[model samples]
Target: MFLRRIPSTIFGIITRSRLSRTIMSESPAKRLKTSPRKIGTHNGHFHADEALAVYILRLLPEYQDASLLRSRDPAALEECDIIVDVSGVYDGTKHFDHHQRTFAETFSAEYKTKLSSAGLIYKHFAPALISLRLNQPVSHPSVELLYQKVYKEFIEALDANDNGINAYPADVAPAFNTGGITLPSMVGALNPNWNTPVDQAGEDALFLQASKLMGETFARKLDYYISAWLPARDFVVDAINKRFEHDKDGRILVFASSIPWKDHLFTLEKELGITEEGNKPLYVLYSEGSKPGWRIQCVPVSKDSFESRKPLPDVWRGVRDDALSEVSGIPGGVFVHASGFIGGNKTFDGALEMAKKALVM
Candidate 1:
């Protein structure tokens, strides 16, 4: 089960704000936060609020111009019709208090470094604003109405963009564009599987074409979800099971980038009886250096070690083979390389899936 960490205090603050009251009021403008000038302007700018903001924007047309803010810019709000803040949604305690001041400072510094790379200034900014009405109650009817309007507009835009001349016959001009002509070749390319007819091929062909262009985006997403995120906890549990099955005769190796993840694995091992089994001992290897132990090996991957192996993949396979042979004494163990955000999970899952399929072979 995935547990979500939320700060109750933040929710309490939002619930108690004056903005909440205004949102609950009956006035349409108060509920909608629509300025007279903004009502006529079809163009709207949206600020990226976090991962959730992307989801929200996906559902709203008026908020379609949304892009992640590289840095905190309070002044940027002046040019936008609405602003969204997503910072409050994260688990503050886990990220901040758990690590103490040093952890918090380090996290902030790293965040600033990313911002600087993107040419953004590191300044304090708030998320979830719909214009000047900062921290207003979000539950008001006006807010809801605005949300609906934005959503509707976004949907319409998507439909128009999807169905315009490129999607239809060259003779058919887009509803939004006046004098532009769509080429038959562009339309044909858009409707590659035209033999199936529009009504029948609509959804399937659209997805097929999109997959070709995006390089199996959906398949990769599925692979990551099943492989990486779902398995982290299970990996620990499985290692414990394997340890017990082997009666400490075999070693368990765990990999992770954070202490919390490491601790979680440790706890899981203990819970699963891997700790108490007299047969094998567990050793943890990390940046603090190596400790002598028995059945378990904890190795920390350090920046220096990573830097020392500069030629990377050309020599990585040989180095990995040597390490595995030394540790497991098992030759020809599978070598899996997973990279990118979901790479770890995808690789893990793909391996398992392939193994399952290979049973038939």
Candidate 2:
């Protein structure tokens, strides 16, 4: 959940100055002959998708010095190298517009909804873009994992919104009435109010403002996946491979070090052929390095679910040390939560034993 925003100072005006100097100092023949690439999107109102699309383009080396043209004029769009969201034509390359009536493109066959400019650009460029940013090899498993992870976790929502996909059924009550701030909603808020007296220039300024917001959000999301999330996946995968070393049936997993494993656990289960209920691990044990010893936690049914696939024995609930040890007939017992979701022990072996006893119960 830790996302580091792509600082406005880095991708904003400061880099613009450096880019200008680099272009200006080049030989007169090279500099004067070639026109700077211009990135085009519509003027007036903006959305998170287009703003994010623009930001994605700027991350590449080629478009670093590219001019941003916020215009509806076809003549202006013709001069630009890449026209996004405004142009009404998608060629799967230079022109990426999703607003046309005939457009029916998606990121993959698994998705039914059409892609917006954000998804379009991300689908085409994100793998390389992420690899370049993180300094990881493009072929790295982490890069591809992060690419899909970012889309599923972040960019997919933008595509859905831009395509006018209703998240809730008409009859269903919303879980959150009004307080949630989605990216599209945030971008929409930056538009000039109906009552406000603003010219096209003012609208253009607001468009840039929206891009800054989207840019920071996109950067932070990417940063989190690259720096924090990908490593956690690797840790989880390794734990899955060595599950049997801890127990006979491989139904209890033990981690040498603590890491975020919840998100990757179920997905790894299916991939590792631990699909059936009997084949899967009932609980996870990890060294609680910062605390006394180890933690034994019930495995959740799924990522968004609070329900455990198999919770600890009900007798262990809310019990501590001596009482828990006496009740369970195991030593080095520490404590178990009231909900039976988690328990702790004074040793790794004790924690593993706790999880095993629960499995039999």
Candidate 3:
């Protein structure tokens, strides 16, 4: 099993006035009034969602001078010169019984609606862009590259079963197969000597064992995927540098769909040395069970938590402010998540318009 710990100094500041000058010299906007752009990225397959966000940002300049300005509040729209919806899904309406409504029927739909209602422009880019940008065949290896390190370790444990009495041969080991077992049967399999009156007990035991083994195998596969896709992280880092031009005061927020995606970003941060004074990045707020290195504040949404919070705009403002302060002296600061907001009546076309307005704001 391969084991390597990511460094704690990934978020360090690289200060050089010369580098900053070079960056600024390359952009025509050096003399223009560049408003603060708020980018909201959602995690989905192929990084297409993020790619869409980037695409929207690219379109902002064009839209700033286009004809899509009549349907929106020119004032509120100006608050953010650019709002990129990196969330990979779109918003749609569904009719249930006698009433009609625009709500997310899938993951993408939910995200689109949330951003739109919040008055942010949302874009839902086709998933194909991700494949095109990657320009890599989706071989078995690529599919397997999405796993996490812990998942790989779990598979190893099942493969080796080296814990003596509890060991199972790699050949017959349930972990070798991706299929899972049922909970009760797995328990029975581990303790076969005991007799149970239920005829289904034996089958249940087998299923339980299989489930445990399957979980381990899945984790291993995930780790492999992440290791393979590390290059994508470089692409994102470069994009940030090019778009923001080493704006140390700006905050970047990244939203991904799964743990693996978050882990990928975490790994990239380590590689790029984005740290705090050569120390680990500080996680001021986080959900329970989120790992330290992941740099994610996993907040599971529920009715109660949702009701207790301030409006989405206020929440976003707070997050943006905090991130900016944290990386006060650094060239750029980033916040990443798998999913940020729920979807509403917003469409990709609307998001493009929003992006355009953001640039001029």
Candidate 4:
């Protein structure tokens, strides 16, 4: 049966009441304020630092929908909630610019180079930015770890470039330079070329393009740390903690699963007070990737160093299978790397035994 439609006057009253109630329920911050928040930067050439700085600010709740203003006019920027890179003022609160003569800000005391807009925002807002992006608490260990890692891996280079600080001394030539295609260089390239007509509108479009590029790079790198790198560190930590269970002397560590463990291994060893002479790791036993056996790897003296603390027996280098078994008197022998840094066996027990034997030799 078709019901009669409600009177138009009554429907309007009900609709208005519900709308008013909904508006009242929203918190002041969540409600559409009188004006959108504003972020101000320079009008001309774009750089990775300010582009990234804008991206980080937008990641936070307060500035998600903020308007960006690029202009050198003081009056235009004065209305912005935050001014970056062009304000010539750095109070460590809102305005962040490193170009001023008196500006002497750094992300940390460990770094000598002055900070750029990217480093400035990261230093103060990293915990919140990371927490918001990853949906993790600001105080989470991962957040704290990533806060430092992101700067070291991504933001530091931008800061150095913006500050005109050379990564190496002037005397030493760089091993390789990508013809200045670094992140900062790429962002700067987004700016209109010298031959192009200068227009505020053109520069603004370039700024947006640069911001998108910087934002994507930050996101991809952060995800790698959170998803792949962090999980591997857990395995490394567990292996380091239980090292003695595999070897009575605690000189050999075993990982049940394969992982990227070199960096974590060296770092954890020092943090766990295992850096002493006998306590230091000499070998690592772990499963091989895409294979059916285990590997015995000699721990390197340093992450970058080619020298291993204790290489496999000389007879095992470049040897395999029956020959290796015959030389070492160990069963299930597989190939040993020519460098003597790693060897493998058909079983976990066999690989562990290989490490133990190498330890003595």
Angstrom error of the Cα, residue 296, model 1: value is 16
Model 1, global lDDT: 0.28
lDDT of each model, Cα atoms only?
0.28, 0.81, 0.28, 0.79
Q: On a 0 to 100 scale, what is the lDDT of residue 42 in model 2?
A: 86
- Candidate 3 Cα outliers beyond 4 Å, as residue runs: 1-193, 196-235, 238-240, 243-250, 253-260, 276-312, 315-361
In candidate 4 the C-alpha lDDT for residue 174 amounts to 82
Using TM-score as the yardstick, the better of models 2 and 3 is 2
What's the residue-level lDDT of 34 in candidate 1?
40
Cα lDDT for residue 272, model 1? 54
TM-scores, all models, native as reference: 0.24, 0.86, 0.26, 0.84
- Of the candidates numbered 2 and 4, which has the greater TM-score value? 2
Ten consecutive residues with minimal summed lDDT in candidate 4? 1-10
Decide which is better by lDDT, 3 or 4.
Answer: 4
Off by over 4 Å in 1: 1-79, 82-112, 116-227, 247-361
TM-score of 4: 0.84
Q: Which candidate, 1 or 2, would have the higher TM-score against the true structure?
A: 2
Q: How many backbone clashes can be found in candidate 2?
A: 0
lDDT of 4: 0.79
